[model samples]
Target: MKHNMFCFQCEQTAGCTGCTGRAGVCGKQANTANLQDALTGALIALARTIQGKQTVSAKISKQIIDGLFTTVTNVNFNDVTIQQRIDAIHRELPAGTADYDMKKVWDAQEDIRSLKSLILFGIRGMAAYAYHAMILGYTDAQLDAFFVKALCAVGEDTWGMDELLPIVLEVGEKNLACMALLDKANTETYGIPEPTTVPLTVEKGPFIVVTGHDLYDLKCLLEQTKDKGVAVYTHGEMLPAHGYPELKKYPHLKGNFGTAWQNQQKEFDNIPAPILFTTNCLMPPRPSYADRVFTTEVVSYPEMVHIDEARDFTPVIEKALELGGYAEDQPFTGINGGHTVTTGFGHGAILRAADQIVDAVKSGAIRHFFLVGGCDGARPGRNYYTEFVKQTPPDTVVLTLACGKYRFNDLDLGTIGGLPRLMDVGQCNDAYGAIQVAVALAKAFDCGVNELPLSMVLSWYEQKAVCILLTLLYLGIQNIRLGPTLPAFLSPNVLQFLVEHYHIAPISTPEEDLKAILGE
Candidate 1:
């Protein structure tokens, strides 16, 4: 049953099993996938060499983070760059340290593989957050230290579930700290996000579309494009950038270009502006727009103009100016057909309204609170989220985050009490905000988070969602309904363990799941 390559870290993995074929569902080729594994193996070797030592350096720590981030779903599809990263890891490691072959972990026993995959993939997700935070000069010593330990553990063949399971949860606990670090870095750098409405219109003349989750990259592009006769538009997860005080201050940061990340291939096919991918969410570009693609940081695709660490965005800006956008303002709408979406209902914004939310729950104006959020993907059955939001019965409130909110963020869900029925809580990393909001509400309501009139019906597509789910489990939150499909990597024993301990279940139809939650 062995195919060319093996990967199941994303929700859209082939056949709900591993994508053990010529190319992954995300368009990652078999060769590139192997190179990513090689890079990870090298990084693990690097970590192992320095393990239990007092002198771990920051540059080594950052390379480990970058190396792990490079292997995440949809990040780097260029085998050339991946091998370069592997070479870099090799040069950085001490003399005679051998790279750990990843095939051992991949070909291990079923439950053993599953548990180690959780720890491995969970830390892979955490690396993205740590990378973002490090770029902002907000590094956590403990988080960096755990990255080394966890990578070593992944390559440690002797470690069983008893050892691996606790590390899996530790990945979540550290990821929480990592996320909080990134959150602090973001708010301190960009200011606490405020509720702001983002338009869906692309203004005339030259402009650039910036996708991916890196706020600093977008900030750099915004600064460079200002008054240079080019405007900037946010796409996918970058939609939340408009809510930050510093980011929103730019008048040239005009509008959002398209829907979530999954639709980029269709939406960017003939767009006049050049697209800058700052991080993950890159799919294989079509020839029509391939010339317009530019990548920065760890996101790389072959033949795309890769922006270097100097951060000079001249190529992207020139490409935009040359392309010359729409002749007139072109209006676009969300997946729900609405022309505007709102964001920045993050933790600070929500907790500021705690008194009102508490009183509304007390008065029965807000009947149930649903966290209908997580990564959105292109799989079939995703419309369940759309339908679920559409049928939320008006008395309930929907709190959403990540790109999945694009499913219903534009809809006029109206108001429950005085608050809007649907609230957009920024990017996927803002799950930290969602966590903080839930805990504060639980405190105000005088009960645990699981006992609050809140339920989590989440849709996941990648490792970021994995770490977040583990965080919820670590917090003892129960009964999370996850779909469009559960992770393919969860073996039967691991699934049973999660079900028995945390009560996580695969999402069924929206109506039936709603009855279960609302009935409770």
Candidate 2:
């Protein structure tokens, strides 16, 4: 039997194995899936051609990074964009070079397939980081070169677990570097994020909702609309924008408009605003608000107005003004009905109060630390994260990132040691920030990171979380509790290896897991 498409790269894969029907669980169609596969194959071909290049240039890095990132889940749904990337790779490759068949890797030995999947998906996530950094005019030659090497390794015929396992971990190593590059670029370009409280209300008047994870795109939109009588509200990963010193300086860069990306279709229904998508987590828009959607920076959808490299958001601005927004301020609340959400507790802000945090811990005022964060999904099991946060003891500090915090970001978790009990650590790319806080805590206590009073309770929905998990594993962080479900691509033996070596556990009920984590 011929399959139209086969994908299991995300947490929501059908049957927890793969999506093999007309569309994936995330709503990706068969045609889009096939096109994405072709795009990946072309990237592998380009990597094979450049396998031993003595010198790779910046142009080569950007294309490969963007292409791989485009294939990430929910990033690009436009067949035209995927085909354009594939065609560009074909033009860039040497004569007679051929694309590698992804089917070979998919149908390989179970262990081999598992290992290669890690490499491919891990790099796909890293590519998002590289792409973000590139947009800010920062590119690390070594980091860029790893994408070529890793992609080549994934396509290699002779590499088995012995060889592929090391490459899988190396994806973590390179992802760390890639994230650091992005952090530097972001902070230097937009200034370090300070702790700021973002309201859930939308102020009266014309406003555009900027979603996705691109700070540069947000910066451009803010600059273009500076005094244009239009307000800018962040959505999803863009919520951290309010903490940036440069970004928050703009009076019109107002509060966040909705919850996580998964709820956009419902939240945006006939909404009187234009939504600008700078990166991933874009759902297929409903007809009610489809005309108000505008995409930019590699995010494309059929029939949506796309803002190109010129960085002009006049079209979006005009649409927002034409909508005229609400005559009265529209008050909004988070999933918990809280009036506001707090963010910007990035490494800089967190570290500023490190002394107080340490003292609080020593005094037994703060009992534990839980990094409960990742992508939020539409699955019913996702409610466990919200409950997990709510059930976490008042003495435990919760540090969250990505869209996962939307599960409970608005909750009033109280505080300890002059720090809010729950802290927001910027976007998924800022996993590096969480790592920094972890490493610093370990050093303060003179122990390994795993020995610190910290636990990583992660919820993965897409490939970016895959790379972040690899980074955590590469750093030897252990006893991580991952849920609401495990990735279906991990063969039994591969899953056992992780379980035995790292004690990785699928999350249980909130009460049971909390007891186990706290040794109660």
What candidate 1 gets wrong by more than 4 Å, as runs, is 1-3
Task: Tell me the tens digit of each residue's lDDT in model 2 across 1-520.
Answer: 3347899999989989899998888788988998898888998898887778866778788889889889889988898988998998899988898888989888999999999999999999999989989988898888877898999998999988899999999999999999999999989988999999998899899999999999889889989998899999999999999999999999988899899999999999999999999999999999999999999988999889999999888899999999999999999999999989988999989888888888999999999999999999987788999899999998999999999999999999898888899999989989999999999988898999999999999999999999999999899989999999999888999999999989999998999999999999
lDDT (Cα atoms) of all candidates against the true structure: 0.91, 0.91
Instruction: Give me the displacement of residue 225 in model 2, in angstroms.
Output: 0.9
In model 1, what are the clashing residue pairs, if there are any? none
> Can you give the TM-score per candidate against the true fold?
0.98, 0.98
Please give the clash total of every predicted structure, in order: 0, 0
Candidate 1 at residue 4, lDDT?
A: 90
lDDT of 1 at 137: 97
- Overall local distance difference test of candidate 1: 0.91
TM-score of 1: 0.98
Q: Model 2 off-target regions past 4 Å? A: 1-3
Tens digits of per-residue lDDT for model 1, 1-520 = 3249888889999889989988898999998888888898998899988888765689898899999999999999998999998998899878888889989988999899998889888988999999999999999878888999999999999978898999999988998899999999999999999999899988899999999999999999888877899999999999999999999999999888898899998999888989999999999999989999999999999998999988999988888888999999898888879999998899999999999999999999888999999998999999999999998888999999999988888999998778898999988899999999999999998899989989999999999999999998888999999999988889999999999999999999988999999994
